[model samples]
Target: MNPLEAQLDYAFADTLPDIGHTLDVAPGVRWLRMGLPFALNHINLWLLKDSIDTPDGVQKGWTIIDCGIANEATRSAWENIFATQLEGLPVLRVLVTHCHPDHIGSADWICQRWQAPLWMSTGEYFSARMMSAGLPGADGSAMLPHFEMHGMRDPEIIAKVSQRKSYYPDMVPAVPHAYHRLADGQRLRIGTHEWRVITGFGHAPEHVALYCADLEVLIAGDMVLPRISTNVSVFAIEPESNPVQQYLDSLEKYRNLPINTLVLPSHGKPFRGLHTRIEQLNTHHQDRLAEVVTACATPRSASDIVPIMFPRALDAHQMTFALGEALAHLHKLWFDGVLTRRLDADKIYRFQTHSAY
Candidate 1:
């Protein structure tokens, strides 16, 4: 539908992994897909062949990357894969791409079963724990004020937003206590190939995407998605954070990889043309920024800009993320000095283009 769509081609656009089945994508790397109850119905996880030590000797196993959410159906699917695939080998290690529930939900169960430790970026590890820990001041406490300040005055919608604070535990009830932290450019060997950690930001703090230059493959977590743009938002937790800039910088990081590299995104089918996708994502936000600046002719709050940017019917849940993203775009404009923000008479924040900048 856009320039990037015309520029990039899906290597196997017609192919998709069946539920509970492993599709051989590359040497020693198997692609697995799982179901989710979201509009984005499914997520793709990876199973990398590996060998690990036991009491007697080394045995073949797997390293699961990006576990699916915690649920009975997902649990059943994993059970089926363990039985059908892996040839009776155990899961040697659990690697998480990020802290979102869809990506790390089953980590606790899988790790406990195989006695494997979670390998995740330091930020993602703690973010997942703190987010799902059901802490007193952690989850929903900040949303009330943030939404209220953003001009969400409807009592019913405000009530729904208020209830989201306690909703994390059901999605991700528990996480393991210990994990091995991954760092940028850290080379890790799996099976026969070496994967270097590529740290990305904005979408999630310190999100890690794995790159195997030897195979020309990149397990682009949420960084280089093929179809839907990753959500880059300014949550109530960090209302002033300039995530849009961080997201742009993160896309720039991916530009250094080969354009024709095979990209295995967490969502969507595997595809090539990383450069084209990067261009699309960058231009997507830049266009959004321009639209936002134009809209600021009449000092607009985040809620005021959501319809301008998204222009769709949003449910209560969708509205929450939309507001956060709208504010994120505004924060980037303010951060770059393209716009100025101030409190209005109603004690709501609004942005307007500065004459000089």
Candidate 2:
């Protein structure tokens, strides 16, 4: 097998073995798999059943864990599934895991249908709104000049910034005018279940993962996926920031969670062993950091170093992201004082050790 495929297989072996096993997660939680043919391929959404009393002795309402993508087909899929499976229950609340398009795309639609209030972490909610509106983030955009000072040039680099400046709009759909802000350690009661909001970062701004201790379940979102590593790329908008470092740091925070707790992730089947996956992800980034350090022994630009890390040919679309992700790692090393930069005679900036710049 090819090295990449083998690495991916080894990383995902345990999770794949029991994927087809039918397991009852809990009385209230139902797992639904949604297909997306994009690079990541799929996303998972959960339906939390809440039994309540009305004029009838008992009725069921639902709290949707995350709204899937906003496309017409995705909406149709959600509609078909809900109609067939949910027995016409109303969605009482729409809880988002993060601001990513795939997760939040249909949020506005779902909220409009059920008149449900949207709930998300305050930072994620505000950032999602800003992203959907095409407004650049302060910290996200602060590092651009640093890239320019490196080998990246004007007009070309400026165009890259302009393109990146619009990424939020490209990915996230516009949310409704109303949403309830959630905070870390906050408790939310829906029907008979009480869900605690656990906020995570580095994957997305203010990512919220829901944990119900009574059920011993965690809606991990993208913060912890079963198969692939979540992309933590540095963008032109966040030129000098080290998203890789941030992502690794964030992974450590989740390592102390209950190891055997069932994790229902956004991209893969529900499973146990959260701490093992967290450790694997942490080690992956640490290895990548080491690779970047080795790559810097000879002065290199972020663009030049991307191929060394990826070691594969990428199309224009892939190239854009590949460059950004490569720069993310380089910036982490640069921030750690392990790397420095110098402007060449041709105006191309190159990076070396701390003494070089």
What tens-digit string does per-residue lDDT give for candidate 1 at 1-357?
Answer: 555565777777669888999999899999989998878789999999988667998778899998899999999999999999888888989999999989999999999988988999999999889988866555865677887788788787888888787666677888889999899999998877899999999999899999999999999998888888899998877778999999898888777787679999998889988998888888899999999999998789999999999998987778888888999999999998989989988989999998885
Candidate 1 residue pairs in backbone clash: 140-165
* Cα-based lDDT for every prediction: 0.88, 0.71
As a TM-score, model 1 comes out at 0.96
TM-score of each: 0.96, 0.82
Q: Best-fitting candidate, measured by TM-score?
A: 1
Q: Residues 1-357, candidate 2: write the lDDT tens digits.
A: 434333232223333322111223666877676656476666778888776566867767888888767777677777776676675788878889988878888899899988878988888788778777866443333345545555444465556564555554544567878789888889988678798888876677788888888877788898877666777776544455677877777776666667667788888667677777777787777888788888778898877777787888765445556667777777788888889867788665677766543
Error of 2 at 211 (Å): 1.7
